[model samples]
Target chain A: MQRLVVLPTSRTGWALTIAFVAVVVAGIWPVIDLVNRAVLFLGLPLLVVWSYVLIFACFAVMLIANRVIEWQEGEDD
Target chain B: MTSPWPLLITLTYVAIAMVIGLRARGGRRMNSLEEWGVAGRSMGPVTLYLLIAAGSVSAYTFMGAPGWAYAKGVAVFYVAVYLAYLALVAWYFGPKVWQFGEQFGHVTQASAIADRYQSPALGALAALVMSIGSIAYAVLQTVGSAYILFVMSGGMIPVWLGVPLVLGCIAIYLFVSGQRAIGRTNAFQGVLMLIVAWAVGMWALHNATGGLRFGPLFERLLAEHGEFLTLPGAGGDMTFSFWTTSIIVSMFSFMPPVWTQWMSASSARTIRRSATWLPTYYVVILPMVVVGFIGIFSLPDLARADTVVLEYAMQHLPVVLVGLLGAGTLAASMSSSEPFIHSVALSWSRDVLQPLLGLSDALTGRLARWMIVPLMALVIAPLAIAEPGSLVMILLVGLGFATQVLPAFIGMFFWPRASRLGVMAGIVAGFLVTVAFTTLWPHPLGVHAGFWGLMLNLPVFVAVSLVTAPADSEVVERFFRIAAPRGLTRLGSGGKTVAADTAAHGG
Candidate 1:
């Protein structure tokens, strides 16, 4: 029952899920509706900057996930 | 090629990369298919990162992306966004692939996918679909590289000669050393493109705006052309739904080159480490697209949007820097093209021809090696010469079909309920729907045909699986067991394992 927690077991899984949602949100409805405008930020368009931020966010997440992921050998009979 | 300076840089870049390729030509004799196809699975983290990074960026980034920025404005940011997600995809799936690759001798994506489902026929189908998609990409590379050579040479190098010249060189090196050559050459090209991409972008930005700072530049552009900085861009060419879905579809688009590079890594950790850094690789797209934004203000009347980078660099930078930029574009294009050609040839020989015709291992390897020349000349050369569409458009069309495989790939790792028959039906239906949507009647409410296809694909996949018999329990067990994430452990298949594999192919 304890193992049934909704949280991802590994950092990699969390990054994978979050990055997936981030991409769709940045690229799709509901979320995209907010960012898809004519404003400028940080010397770039607000929308373009949004994409850059997402890329960096994914990068940051994977950096954390990579630290946690490890390889183990299968059992020997 | 009147501009000997750029032509010289291009030539020098070519010579250095050729030397790297020749040096990577594997030892003594051309040996096992593993050595040829996956570099004997001996790539370290740095080598794999460079190879994957180079494989991702192409003439499209140097030329087409800026053109999209120049012509369509903010729409080009789709390129950068999708790539970041691609890195995350690689990190999550790559280790599992590396695990499976070790336990089984799977050298191609189709082989691995087919093995998971315990279906050779499914593998063959995947091989066939991916071959078409990969060849379409190879064609884009051929056309894109030829365009660079032609333009840089000041019309001295014609498209006819340029296509074969670039293709011939790549074919020979790939033939000689296979994936080893690609890894070595990619490392050289990848570093050059990243540095040159930023330099050219900064120069263009500064030249156009009087400074490299983007806030002022965007502010100015907002004053002059407010619409260019927002969705649907300048002329409202790409709408909100189209742009968003394009990013989503392109992000998930299946590429065998990525998997090929992943399988070659020494361990799953090597892949995870490499994937961690891959998002930074999108740095190339940022500057290249900035160059595009610069072109909008500086050289707004260019005949072809695809020539935005070339035209902008010529106007702003010195001859030497322009030449260097030209060299980088060509090097980037050539570096990116070879892997697709190699992957296509691999899937054809290992996954399709071997299984379809029942060819022996030795025979398939020999046949695959010989197949590259005709495959390029007869199939890809015509399209390269035709210059059928913009690099991004042709690339997207290919991606539409490639994205059809996403359900299958996702089901491989996550969904135990996914049956081979169910997945296969979904793929076929999705492929057909995508083709019809892209060709027969496009702009289905401005949602990319691929996204719409996915809409139809998911239900069929789930519905059919609900009714179909599950895969054999033993096969299913092996699939999940091998793919399950685990802590650091000993390598399984090497009999005398010592931390898995890596030292490159001889050199």
Candidate 2:
């Protein structure tokens, strides 16, 4: 039986794959260092706010990139 | 001091939903299974957004999130963490799924994967797994709705009656109107539930704490019961690892059924636009979280943390408002249950039945409606017999099905050489690993088993895909021709054939 596959073949795809993996790893790494006390003055609110902004920005960039790629493809057509 | 007005108002809401469903049945132009199951695959952004929000933010969010916050303190904020991640997933995958759905005329996630991988067996397996998980999910909603009714009626309504009643409504609506009814009712329920949630949240917080300020309450909790506020507190409460893992799990869990919804969107642009703004629902949930926080300070000693929101509303809010809150909770459960019922039916009829029986889309859509009765009975009967578990735990278990979809769905977009062999291997491996981790292990390094399973699944997906020979180039090219960036700019040359088939088949 012939196998069927679906996905894009492009640098953008590879980049996204790498970035997603990196974020998953980095986001969870802090859970391992249980006893290490880092004295930071930043409050939970600031951290929460910062994380939201960061995540939103990441997705915004991804959406924009996809849009640009589509636009470029339209131009090529 | 008793009043029947609250019960009257809630009955009115239920009647309105049923009326909407009946009206929607008149507009049925369902010539195909996709049109029946996914609203003819023609939902606009607003409708799609409402459908998604209504389908996702279930009774769990109405009661469970706040209840969790009340019990676990700040750690409950992880719910928001997952909601944000869910939006990201939707934003990334939504348009692509829509494009593929449009091309293949796909109705279910399994059909999409099966088509992409050229494996009917894989599709059957996916449909089976999804059905099992979705039925479990439906039961959870049944339990939630029953619990709300039981509580609201002050135990006048028995669990058996309530469970069947709620499931009956879902079955009737799903049978009568299909996805059109689901979308319309979801839109109405979504608005009512949101308003009720916001009103109850704001009113409860204002009345309990005398203002929106939670600073004093937080400080008090810290002083007296600091353990509840922090992870793995002195009392062996939730740990930081647990909190982090739960966040990750919740974020990723939005993939499975939601992907089906994305595929059902009317257009790629609708999917894109919906993804962009859907996170606002998460933003609206802040008030619910605040209500939970307020509950901690006001009713710190309350038992059964899942009842925190309801208990607070009962104790503090006026009678009419309490009924509204009860209706809102019911709406949350019904909104999710209705769409899920339709999706489950679609999965069975499209992925399992059509392939097995060689039935046309019209036959399948009719079969799907017939399937809803047995499905609802299956879910509600068990819920009535068995006691409900922790809402979060139940939610997580239901969400485990979603994790299984990650490798195949994500690989479709990002990994070009992802073969059917690899996708199948990944799915089987993911399922086994998730089940083993969940059942056999107490805790894998103090993290949820789903996280461990996901960790295992990703590597299996990559390793198998890389080691296996690539799929046929023609198939790959066709997929890209329909789904890639360039594909988005121009309609497929094969569009004529699909349109012809749709017209012939009554899509």
Task: State the iRMSD of every prediction, in order shown.
Answer: 11.3, 9.1
Q: Pick the candidate with the highest lDDT.
A: 1
Model 1, which residues run further than 4 Å from truth?
Answer: A1-27, A70-77, B26-28, B388-397, B485-507
What DockQ number belongs to candidate 1? Answer: 0.36
Tell me the lDDT of model 1 at B106. Answer: 86
Off-target runs (Cα >4 Å) in candidate 2 are A1-77, B226-240, B254-256, B388-398, B466-470, B486-507
Per-prediction TM-score to the true structure, in the order listed: 0.90, 0.85
Q: Backbone clash tally for model 1?
A: 11
C-alpha DockQ of every model: 0.36, 0.16
Clashing pairs for model 2 are B31-B506, B35-B40, B232-B238
Q: Going through the candidates in order, state the TM-score of chain A alone for each one.
A: 0.59, 0.46
